[model samples]
Target chain A: MSFKVSEDVAVCGGRLLKLSHFSQVIGTIMNVNVYLPKQYYSQTDNKVIPAVYYLSGLTCSPQNASEKAFWPFQADKYGFAVVFPDTSPRGGDVPGDPEGSWDFGVGAGFYVNATQKPYDKHYQMYDYIHKELPTSLDEYFSNGSRLDFVDNVAITGHSMGGFGALAGFLKNYDANRYKSCSAFAPIVNPIKVPWGRKAFGGYLGADEEAWKGYDPSELVKKVSNRGNDRILIHQGTKDPFLESNLKPELLLEASKGTSWEGKIDLKLVDGFDHSYYFVSSFVPEHAAFHAKNLGLI
Target chain B: MSFKVSEDVAVCGGRLLKLSHFSQVIGTIMNVNVYLPKQYYSQTDNKVIPAVYYLSGLTCSPQNASEKAFWPFQADKYGFAVVFPDTSPRGGDVPGDPEGSWDFGVGAGFYVNATQKPYDKHYQMYDYIHKELPTSLDEYFSNGSRLDFVDNVAITGHSMGGFGALAGFLKNYDANRYKSCSAFAPIVNPIKVPWGRKAFGGYLGADEEAWKGYDPSELVKKVSNRGNDRILIHQGTKDPFLESNLKPELLLEASKGTSWEGKIDLKLVDGFDHSYYFVSSFVPEHAAFHAKNLGLI
Candidate 1:
């Protein structure tokens, strides 16, 4: 339940704490990087700093987004801590893609709880990311009562992690798990997309009904909007995976006539691609969106 | 004299143009990345955008700083373009380190023209970076006269590139090549350090006099300061190579009684390492310094 600090780096006006801890849910050590804004260190008025969780895409560790996403600056500006979690569990005994492909094994857990064969033992990333990770972080950093990891928090991600954010947010919509949600070039209709179909088939088995539970397109139709809550999303027009693996329009189409209609603000940015260059470019806007939703404004 | 565009990426209200060109000075193809800020595109006011050449550290290419330095946002903020130059000439028939080390060859050009045998063929980085590259860029982009790659420019770098910026700026001090200069964890006294001695000896062939021509510590005493001009620098206290390789204080010590005394602003930032994390953290400050010097602020 306790995290071991591997490196505490000074970035921006705060510290980026690279932490590793044994996960009871995933049955493996999970790595997460947390950036505590300067407000956390010098809070004479004892203000409770909120947190924003940023999930990464395939073939990325906690280090990629921590280094290139340019979140530390915005984190400092909004007085919020940023959490960056690993894409999947790694190391010994972890079963990788059977075909030895990058999209299926090792780096690509797709943030799903596997119900299939060999994967069932360790690939419980859905539970790990949404449930245990947050609880553990809340317990670890809430000692001083200066950091709020659970209550006053927002969520955002890129690519595959975008789908994870949409799915996770909708699944826990009734409970209000995340105050706000946003994604950069996210895989929205995972059930319809090739990447999501493969991941869902492998992790949740061929049961399409089980896949529906994690599909954002389906979730938008099922989950009722509480108030005037909106989900911000930015998709690149030049993204290569647009038509094939990430059909974001399916979510908008599915949300038609549902409570989420017109509530999913999808902005297609011109000339942007599916890279950290794209993610970091619009991070300022997303940070501002999350900041307002988290009441930091 | 012309550059080939490989990847033109849209990032942070601008485009990052990944370019490769045949260098007349180095006798090989050199890769570079240039970022044109938003002002270049929507220029109804006809502003002449200045350029800032950022040299990378050892074991780095133009891509390292282009991807992680977080310069595009600042460039967009100040309406100045950024040019990221490769550390060394690479590829087909280009010889690397004899010892197969990262610090001596390939990515570690040290930004000096080599007078030695094998290295002399393609290691003319000093002339390439400070001379031919700028002249070629000016010719290529000055068709509209909206981009000032030559007349109004600044230079800044990290580690080895930091040393390069200082050496290049001082050697061309009388010529007034760069309007402003700054560095992040630079190798100021390279002639005295192990990395410097190895690079200088290998490239300049053991001639201490030839090495002094590219040493900032030596050039600081030789080059008279023009007016109240200053060089901004940020060195992380926790940088691993501070003591043995990057002794920044030596430059200040060398400038003690010279015309450049107190003109070198070396800031010692606490708890920061020698990673892009540290560079990106201080880039805004360096950008502002260069902006003021380039008359962008």
Candidate 2:
């Protein structure tokens, strides 16, 4: 859990650290981006700050969401922490392809715990993100740095990341696992989509029953707690994939008739599409949402 | 001019155009980033909009000012145009740099009319940005697009680009040239600095008097326009180049002892450094400055 790429981002010399951590479940080292806020050093009484994990969509590495989205500004302002992990495991030791397209292989990690032979060895993104990443971040970044008033944990992501964030939050649901779970252009119900079919089948074998465990729709149906206090989703009306991969409607369906106290706010912003331009447009809102829920701002 | 980079940037479409012109003096082809208000297409034009051109420091193209600092969101609210031009001409068979360091070569096209050999042929950034870019934009972007509200214009830049913005406004001194001028960590008093010495010596030759024409301090000293304009500068106490390259004191000195008509607002943002992070922290303020001048919220 040593830092590799460190850049001086803000005053008080707050540093953004990118580290390579060996995920025990996946058996591969994953690169993660961490924004150590301005108060990290000043209040070094070992207080833990609230953290929001941002998962990237397809064809994106940890760098895409960090550099392109300008996440540090929001992270710095709200005085919370943000963690960016690579979308998927690479190298053929993991399953090579689910139909081998740009949308699936290499870049698309789908945030699932793989069950198939080749993939099961390395494609444990669910555990790597939900469990391993938290453990690593706790030991490495918070060392000697007070993070108090920052522990309103939240999970948020974009597109595939949105799905991943949902899974990460639901499966790890504790009394205070995540205060909020929000997504930008999230593919809410991945179990019924083409992307989900290929990725789930290739990584999790031919079992649709197992897929339900990772599916947001199924998770809400089976689990009653849903410790994430709220879920906010922003969907673009003009998103070409809105009707297909990013079916926000199914999540709406899943939430119905459940005693779960979590609220899902689905906002369809006009003229927005599935691009970084759209993500960046609403990124401030998303950051503020988590910040408010986390009690940072 | 067609839009190349227009998606939803903070509720508006940010447009960038590749402009080509038969400039009698400078290069024939250049690119500029244009941010149009969301209402530009939707609103019926009953009024005009004000715009500001931001110049970047050394070793950057027009895209640097746009990408490094998320200017489109700001431009959207300002309801004005933000044109960022390439610092200098390239791909023309001009003198190649013998030195490889970026400070002297292609990227560092100091916004000055070069008199030195090799550079003299095409190093006409001053004219390109000032005359050519404006002329082309006025012809193509302002008139052809729904940007009729571009009646007011302001200029702002960072580091060397800041010097260029001030020098351009003061040298031209148009009540119409720009309604305001501002900067973040600008290299003020370029004629009296080491960086200015090398760049001016190389481009404008060793004649200090000739170099003075390109210096903002000298230009501000001669300001005759006595009403309704002000200059704003935000300097960082921790900027590494504060002592040598950026002399905000020189600008203050030149503006002293005269009504000068134009006000100077020099601010020292505490603990900020000379990075995109620093600029980004206050980018909204600069954009709003132009917006208020543009008569839009």
Candidate 3:
């Protein structure tokens, strides 16, 4: 878990840090982009802002959300930390495309702790993100952030990462660990979708019962789903993956049309695609939505 | 040339056209993004506005400039047409990189009309951009555009495209082709620079004489240096390539210290890199710069 403060960019008084981490989880060194909003320092009396961890989709890294998705301005205004970790580790330790066709190899960390042979050595994203990664970030921003705020964390993501956030939270539901949660265009059930099936079959080795542990719909159904009293979900109406991979309705079905369904606020945005343009067009609102619920003001 | 008008995003009443072309010169089918400002309809009854073509650098397509670069507002103010052509052709008959790499194979046209081996069959960028490309664009804009305004074209690009714009204006030297020129962090002298040497040597063979035909420094030495007069070059002082590849001094030297010395208006931006962050920061000014010169305002 050792890292050097190699590069720093002055962004709205806070710093955008790029840290290189060699992990047993992802095997190779991972580059994570952490955004410490200006409020972390301006408060002066040492107040840690509530934090949000944003995970990108397959074929994406921490850099994708920070640079392309326009997350900082919203983070700066709302006063929160945004942690973006790479999808998968790079270099030799992690196995990549023997046949170099985009997706599935380097940038694709399916969020499941890998159980298959070769991948098991490196692919431990579930643990890396949910457990160890946050522990490290807790220290990284502590210099400028207050200890109270770090404890008040919210986890959310897009596509695969969205699915990851749900599974991660449901699996580790010690209400004390995280204060709230949400997702933008999440893959609700991986076992049911093509992308999820392929990734799950390859990584987890075809155990249907075991697969339920990683599926949000299944996880939500079994457990009484509790985090924030309200879970905000934003999905683009025109996303190509909407009808298939991201049937957010599944989460609704799993909530079993009960009180938990009332807890999930689903927003359908118009004329948006699966691309970053779609995410960026609505990132500002999502940040504010989380901030308001967290009472960050 | 039979492009089926796939997607059109209208900004300021001017349609950004995505056209398909079998670029015999570049040896593939190319996608070009053209922006027609509001003035195309507002200015004079049937008044056609002059145009400026913007070429992007490595790993980028025409869409990159138009989408996130924030060029629409500036284009509307200028009342001119801005064209963005794909860096290179893809999935066509063109024999591009049997082994793909980001630099030489695709998305990195270097804007040079290739001459070596497999590249020569389709990599005729010089002809495609300077000749075939504009002919159709002139026809598309129609009316006076097909007549006078379209002919009064200025060329500019960032990085590799900057080098392209310089070479296009120089070698072609069609008084009717490009009326003026400028660049954004362009690779000025390829022969003297590592990137240029690798690309030119591979594409044009070891012919220094032929390379000269493409080098801005060499081209400037032969032609009217101040032709870039009233031209503006916006570069970041912190640009990583400032010393190595984009030696503005080489361009400064090529003009015999006379042409663009100060008149060309070299702006050295502080605390910026060669990345889009730097480009996005100053793209508005560049649009305005060309718009003023093109008389679209």
TM-score of each: 0.99, 0.81, 0.69
Model 1, which residues run further than 4 Å from truth? Answer: A43-45
Per-residue CA lDDT of model 1 for A112-202, tens digit only, reads 8999989999999999988999999999876766888888889999999998899999999899999999999999998888899888898
True contacts kept of each: 0.89, 0.20, 0.00
Candidate 3 clashing pairs, residues 3+ apart or interchain: A48-A146, B25-B124, B26-B122, B26-B123, B26-B124, B27-B122
Candidate whose TM-score is highest: 1
Taking chain B only, the TM-score of every model is: 0.99, 0.88, 0.89
Shift in Å, residue B193, candidate 3: 4.7
Write one digit per residue (lDDT tens) for candidate 2, span A1-297: 544554444522355566676678778767777766765655553445677888999989877676556666676677777788898887536666656687765788788877777777888888778767776667765655555322457888999999988877777665456777889998778879988887888888787898888888888766676344677889988899999798898888888987453477889987677877678777788889988888776
Worst 10 residues of 3 chain A by lDDT: A141-150
lDDT agreement of model 1 with the native: 0.93
Residue pairs with backbone atoms closer than 3 Å in model 1 (clashes): A97-A105
RMSD of 1: 1.0
How well is each residue in A1-297 modelled by candidate 3, as lDDT tens digits?
Answer: 566665665443365777777766666777888877767657454555777888889888777776666666677787888888878767876786455754566777777788987777888888888777877766654564463334678778888888887777667664556566778799988889988887777678878777888987887666564444667788877788899889998888878755466677888876556766566656767788778866787
